[model samples]
Target: MPKSVWFLIIGMLVNTTGNSFLWPLNAIYMHDYLGKTLAMAGFVLMLNSAAGVLGNLLGGFLFDKIGGYKAIMLGIFLTVVSLIGLTQWHEWPHYVWLLTLLGFSGGIVFPSMFALAGTAWPEGGRKAFNAIYLAQNVGVAVGPALAGIVAEKGFDNVFEVNLWMYVLFFFIALLTFKRFETDSVVPKNVVSERKRITNKASLYALLIISSSSVLCWIAYSQWSATISSYTQDLGLSLKQYSLLWTINGLLIVAAQPLIAPLVKRWENNLKRQLVFGVVIIAISFGIVAFASDFKMFAAAMVVLTFGEMFYTPALPTIANQLAPKGRQGFYQGILNSATTVGRMIGPLFGGIMVDQFGMMALMSILVIIVVIAVIPCLVYDRPLVKRSKSTTVLE
Candidate 1:
């Protein structure tokens, strides 16, 4: 791997660690600490996700126009500002405002980062994204475990730690990522990339692929939303719930080596790979519906991680393939925006189901949602009929 990618990986690890400290705990803090109902907490989170959607779109556009260095730094600066505010004021209205700001800032950073990674290493293909994904999970593993320990003292410590990690991440990117952005020497596969499709067809393909992405996140976000409450209601402590994510992170890191051969076999057929992942996630949610113990919830998380290992990296890879000469960042932004839409609606949806119908109903619907994602994955590429050159079609 290139040193630039390594820096990006390192930056991503730190960035995600900071994010993990708050995200996994957000709903819990809203409900338990701040005296809000689950529905209200979900509504606030919905607003946060809405901001993230806008940020994702704007960030991708900025990356294409201004270059990744400036765009990413802008995002980091804003994110740092949000964290500073969060560290000082964490009461109800203040927390909600800062968290939403964090979402927007964080959203701006991600597509730029992913686009840079893909740009830095187009030849590396899935390898580049896989590494970034691994870094994120490693942060996920480490962040929440440390957060659990810190929260044993107080939630205020969690905010401070999160702020410091983002600060470290900001400095790391400031120092290293600029060189990477200026030094993008790898040639793009322009002829092959533009051979078979129109920009409109490609954009439609992305939207189709993103539909599955959205659905998968709806099911996946439950682990952070209703499932957290469900586990606590069943007598698990905060530490134990945090440990579940630690296990998820560690499992994703360790299981990659074992899952590689299967991924390699499905390398040419991303749709097949995605189908396998979605099915496994559906099965995992099925397990969650019946789970009553920490071990069972842990088992569900393990299964969930396995599914995403196949599912997550492919979305960005597909976007890279579909992107035209100058739209890689924009395409990546669309993919991220889809996932944000899922995350945005998921909590409120889950909260409603749990509040009215109960836990079993919530779990059942999650499994169905996961299963439904496969349809889009299968059909997203159908409209592309090979042509001599890239054409801009009105359709």
Candidate 2:
């Protein structure tokens, strides 16, 4: 890996660490602390995710036009300003407004980061993405543990800690990324010619894969949304819920070394890997449907973490691989947008389902959604493969 990639990973760690403090607590804070209902909390989260959708699109465009360094810095500045405001006015409508702003700003950072990682260490293949994913889990592992402790004192302290983490993140970006460039690994002319031949197939594959990505996120999001609330209904405390995330993060971080060799065995078979991961995720939700205690929830989380470990890194790598030259940022943006869309809808969808139906129905529906998502994953590569065969026959 290049020095730039290392710096990028470290920056991701700081970025996610800061975000972890707020995200896990968002629904709980809104419902329990702010005297809002679960549905209202879901609505606020939907607004936040909607802002992120815009940010993802805009940030990717900026990365392509201005380059990663400037785009990322711009995002960091917006997020920092939002965080500062949140620290002071974290009450009612003010909290909603500030969180939406924070979501938009934070959204801008991710597409640029993933685009940079793809460009920075193209030769590193999936390792580059895995490193970033690992860094993310490290933040997840550290942030929630500390956040639970801080929140026990006061929710205000949680906001304060998050604000400082972003402050550190801003400095790190300023110091390390000032000289970063967004040049393609392949030459521009070569990429242009290749695009003329491969554009249609690539676009089709991206769309299919992106559809699957959306479904995965919708189901995955329950952990932070309705599932969090459900645990409280079952007599769990905030700290206990935080510990679930902590366990998730630790498992992701700790299990990577053991899991890497197995993954390598299927390194070239990403489609199969995705299907397997998605199936595991579906099963995990099924487990959640039956969970009544913290131990059962922990078990479900562990299963969910394993599924994520397999799926998370591959999605971005696939997007990067299918991207055509200068459009890398654009394709990556689409991928982010898909996840954002799922997130935008997931909370409200889950909240309504749980409220109107019940937890059993919500979990069961998620399982079915994930299972249906597998069809696209299995077929997304067919177009590319057929195209390759025809080209071979012509030659």
Candidate 3:
């Protein structure tokens, strides 16, 4: 692996380790530990997602102005502050506000990292992305699993570890960034040509892709929302739910890298890869809708894993490719924004459906969303094929 690859891997690992603890237990922690109601917890999460939108814009603008290095450092600093505040806070609103800061900080760093990685290699962005994803998955896998154990001890233990991880990331980033570029920003003088894709085409694709991305989040978000309820419906414990997340993470780690190369080989087109992923994800949701027993649920999870293996890596890779010069960060930010949008909506939708109509209803709605996401993808083949020529940068 190249140095850039190592950087992304390490960065993602550290960042994701922090994410693992928060994501699995964030809402639960708010509701149970802080004595907030479920509605309050959801509201807090919504605030974070909303703040993340601004963070994405801030990150992109900073990347374009000061440079990716500076933007990332700022992100790390903010994250450290947020984590520390979160660790110390006991009041409901206090924790919620701190978590909002954490989300915003993460948004800043996440897209900035992608922008930097895109620029860093000038080549191997795709594979580097795969490595980053792999490392991220590994961290995610370990974080939640470790947090599950730590939750038994106390949420404070996990929060404390998270603070340490962010602190370590901050210093490591400072050290590693010395040799990286911040001197010459992407020049604004280059002649910008919108590719053959019309504005309408691009917008349509964006909406479709965003919708599907939202569906993806909905499916994934179920782990926190309906899936846990379904598990308890079958008489499982929170530990068992955590185990399910562990299994999901492990599958992502084991399957993604193994299939990434093959997927790249077979379908180098980013749009196609995304479409493929959506189709698979739709199928997975269908499986979940019908599944009742633990074995059936496990099978559905396997399908969901396959869908993730295709989709998660493809989205960012495509965003980097589709992004105009000097605006890689902006496009990546938009992609992340789509994800934040999904996070905001997916849980709310899932919760409503689960409460009102149960798991099958939730799955059914997601399936329709996924299907809607597929049409524009199929129609946009020409642009994707043209964009496919840029593969050398990432190959």
Tell me the TM-score of model 1. 0.94
Q: What ranges in model 2 sit over 4 Å off? A: 184-194, 389-395
The digit string of per-residue lDDT tens for model 1 on 1-395 reads: 99889999999999999899989888888888998878888888888898999999988988888888888899999999998898899997999899899889988999999999999988999999999999999999999999988887999999999989988998998899989784332245555444434777788889999999999988888888888878878999999999999998899999988999999999999889899988999999999999999999998999889999999998899999998767888999999999999999999999999999998998888888888899998999866653323344412
Q: If the candidates were sorted by their TM-score against the true structure, best first, what order would they fall in? A: 2, 1, 3
lDDT string for model 3 (71-132, tens) is 88999999988888877884667887888898899889888887777777657767656667
- Give the clashing residue pairs of candidate 1, or none: none
Residue 379 lDDT in model 1? 90
Error at 324, model 2, angstroms: 0.9
Q: Is candidate 1 or candidate 3 better by TM-score?
A: 1
How accurate locally is residue 136 in candidate 3, as Cα lDDT from 0 to 100? Answer: 79
Q: Please count the clashing residue pairs in each candidate, in the order shown.
A: 0, 0, 0
lDDT of 2 by residue, 205-239 (tens): 98899999889889988888899888988999888
- What's model 2's lDDT at 128? 86
Per-residue lDDT value at 115 in model 1: 93
Q: What is the C-alpha lDDT of each candidate?
A: 0.88, 0.88, 0.72
